[model samples]
Target: MIYDLLIVGGGVNGCAIARDAAGRGLRVLLVEQTDLAAATSSASTKLIHGGLRYLEQYEFRLVHEALAERELLLAAAPHIIRPLQFILPHEPSVRPAWLVRLGLYLYDHLARRKRIPGSRAVTLAGSAFGAPLAGAYRLGFSYYDCRVDDTRLVVLEAIDARERGAELRIGAKLVGARRDGDVWRASISGADGRIESVGARALVNASGPWVQETLTQRLDLRSTKHVRLVKGSHIVTRRLYAGDHAYLLQRPDKRIVFAIPFETDFTLIGTTDVPFSGAPGPVAIDAEETDYLLDSIRHFFRVEIGRGDVVWSYSGLRPLFDDGALKASVVTRDYAFDLARAEGAPALSVFGGKITTARRLAEHALETLAPFFPRLGPAWTAQATLPGGDLGPGGFDAFLAEVTRAKPFLPPSLARRLAGAYGTRLWRFLEQARSMDDLGEDHGCGLTEAELAFLRAEEWARSAEDVLWRRSKLGLRLDGAQQARLGRCF
Candidate 1:
C-alpha cells in the first residue's frame, strides 16, 4: 500500500510531522534508523524558551514564533512542560545591562505570553536566589521559559501519530530509495536484519543531523542546501544550588551557559557550540568541553566544581542551515525546507530547528506539502493534548496529589515521579499493584518490573538504554549493577 507520506527520521520533527499529517486524514509511515529521539532530540538543553540569545542576532521573527509555541505547548503538555524562571545575572564585561534589558523587553512583548510571567529586574544581593552567586553579580534579570522531558515529548508525539493511523517503524533504517513513476519505493532494514520496502506519494527528510546524508547517500539525491553540524554538549553534576530557578551565565567570550536544576538531585550545565567534523552517531562529550562547562560555572557561581564532581555528560549534533556564518555560535537556530520535485515523486528535506519550535515546523512542513496532498485537514494540533497530558482543570499539582492520595501504599517519591512522567495514565499500570512487591523487583532508583513492562509495551522501548535513558532519566540515578540487571531483564 502506498502511504500519503513516508517520513525518514523519527526525531521530534519527523514524529511531529507524522502526527500532524495523520491527523489530517493522511496515511503516514515514519522510519527511524535507531530509537526515537536517540539523537539531537534527546540531547537538547531541554528548554522550551524563545531563544533569548537569538534576540541579539535580530532574529525577532524566530523568537516570536518560538515564544508563541512555548505557551501552546505548556498548555498542551502540562505534565512534562512547565514554567522555569531564568536568572540572567548582569555581566557588564560581557553584554551591557541596557542591551540585556532591551532583549528581555523584546522577549516579553514579541509574543502574547499568557501563562508565563514577563521579564523583570531583580536585586540579587543577600537574596535566596543570590546565595549561590558571587558578590560581583548583584544585579540580575528574571524571565520565564519552560523545562521539558525531551525524550518523553518525542515518544508522546509518536504515540499520538500512531494512534491517528500512522505507522512508526523504530529501529528501522532506510537503506535506499528510488523514484518510481508517481510513487517512491524505499527499502528499509529493521534491527533484526529484516528488510522491507514501502511506497509513498511524498517523503519528508526530518532526520535531524543526518538530513544531508539521507538525501545524498541513502536516496542518491542532491540539493543546493546543506547542513552545518554544530556539536552541543552538556554535563550533569551534583545539585549546585537549592532553588528551583535556573541561571543563564554569560562568558567572557559572550556565549551563555545554563545552570539548571535537574532530577531533583543534580544540576544540569552545558551546551558548547563547536563545529563538529566527525560522524554524528555515538557522540560523546570530550574532556575539553567538560572543562569549558565547569569553568563557566566557576566564573559565575561561588561553588567550585571539577571533573571529579561530574556524574554524567552527553553531546548532540545540530543540523543547522549553513548560512556562511564564521562561528558556530552565530549559526541560525531557525529551520528551512528544501523541496525537490524533479521528474517523478517529490521529497521535502528539513534543515535546522530547535525543540521549542518543532510543532510549528511540522505545521509549516504540512503547508509546504499541501499541494501534493490537497485533501489534508486543517491544522488542529495547536489545541490538542498529547497522550496522558490531560489532568483535568487542576493541572499537574492537583494530578500529583490525586495519584499519591489514591496509592497511599506506594512511596511518595515514586508516586510523584510516576505521576509526573505518566500524568493521568499513571493509574493505568499502578491500578493492579497493591504494594511494593506487586511492582516487582526494584532495579534501584525506583525502576521496577512493572514500569519496565509498561515502557516496553507502550512506549516502544527495546533496549535497557531506551528505558533507562530515553523513556525516563533513571540512568542518572541507577548504578552500574542496577543498569546491568536492567539490561539482563529486558
Candidate 2:
C-alpha cells in the first residue's frame, strides 16, 4: 500500500501527526524503533503549560500557541491529563516582585484560557501550600498548567490513529528510503530482524533527537538545519511536601525547577538543562544534575534530602533547534518543519517541539505539506476527544465514582488509577469481569494479569518496562521479583 504519510519516529510529535493525518482521511503509517514513547516523549517535565519562562525570552507567540493548546487538550483528554497548579515562591534575590508579577500577568493573558484559572498572589506564611517551605519564603504566586502520562498520551495518539485508519509498526526502525517517481520507497527493519519494504506518497521525519542522523544516515539527505541535544533529567524521591499542588523553584542562575507530586506517594523533581554531547539513547541522570536538584530543593524546603534520598532517576534528550544559544535552557521550544521535494514526493523534517504544542505541530506539518496533497481533509482534532478520553460530559471525578460504584470488587485506588489511565474505555476490559479473580493474577501495586493482557494486546506494550515505567509509574512500587515475573510475560 502506498501510504499517504509515513512517519519516521513514534514520539509525541510523530504519533500526534499520525493521529491527525489519519483523522483527515489520509493513509498514514507510523514506525517506532522501540516501544511508543521510549525516548523523548516519556522524558518530559510533564506539564501542558505555556512556558512561562519562555516569556522572559520574548517568545510570546510560542507561549500563546501553547496556552491555547493547553485548554484545548484539557477538554480533549481530561483522563490522563489533569489540571495542576505550580506555586512560584518569591525570591527577591533572584528577581524583584514587579518583574515576576508582570511575567505572571503575561503568562495568564498571553492566550485565551477557559478551563484553567489564571495566576494569583498568595501569602505562604501559614498555609498548607507553604508548610514545606523555609521561613524566608513567605510570598508566592500560583498558576495553573497540566500534568500528563506522557507515554500514554503517545500510545493513545497511536491508538486513535489506528482506529482512524492508520497503520502502526512499533519496534520497526526506518532503515533507509529513496525517491521513486511519485512515491517514496522505504526499507524498515523490525525487532525480529525482518526487513520490510514499503511505499508512501510522502514522508515525515519526526525523529525527535535523531532527526539529523535520520536525515543523513537513513535517508542520505543533507540539511541546512541543525539539532542540538540537551539532556533533561528527573529524580523520584519520597514526597517532599504535602498537598497536590506543585512548587516551581527559582534558581540563582535564572533557571526554574519543579517539585511535583508523583504516583500519589513520591515527588517528581527534575529537569536540569545540561548540554549533552553524547550518543542518543536511554540516558541516566548525571551526578551533578542530581546535586543540582538536591541543592535546589534544600535551598527552599526545610527538609533533609540528598543523593541517598533519591529512589529513581531518568533522563531524556531534548532535540532543540540549535540556533547557537549560549545556554541550553533558553533554546527555542518552538518547532519548525523543513519541507523538501526534489522532483519527487515531499519529505517534511520536524525539529524542536514540546508536548504542549504537539497537536499544533502536527496540524502545521500537514499545512506545510498541503501543496503536495491538495485533496487532504480539513483540521478537526481541536474538538475531537482521543480514544477513551470521552468521559460523557461527567468529567473525571464523576467517571471515577461511576467506575468504583460499578466495580465493587476493585479497590478504590486501583479503580481510580485504571479509570484515569483508560478513561471511558475502562469498560472494554473491565466490563466482562465481575470480581478480582476474573481480573487475573494479582501483581503487587495494583497490577493484574488482565491489565497486562490489555496493555499487550491493545496498546503496544511489549515489555515490562513499557507497562511499569512508561504506561504507568507502577514500576516504582513493584519489587525485583515482581518485575522479573512481569518481564517474563513479554
RMSD of candidates 1 onward, in order? 1.0, 0.9
> Which runs in model 2 stand beyond 4 Å of their true positions?
none
Alpha-carbon shift of residue 191 in model 2 (angstroms) = 2.4
TM-score of 1: 0.98
- For candidate 1, give the lDDT of residue 117: 97
For candidate 2, the per-residue lDDT at 177 reads: 95
Q: List the residue pairs that clash in candidate 1.
A: none
lDDT of 2 at 432: 89
**TM-score for each model:** 0.98, 0.99
Report, for every candidate in turn, its global Cα lDDT versus the true structure: 0.91, 0.91
Compared with the true structure, what per-residue lDDT tens digits does model 2 show for residues 195-294? 9899999999999999999898888788888889999999999998889999999999989999999989999998899998977887888889999999
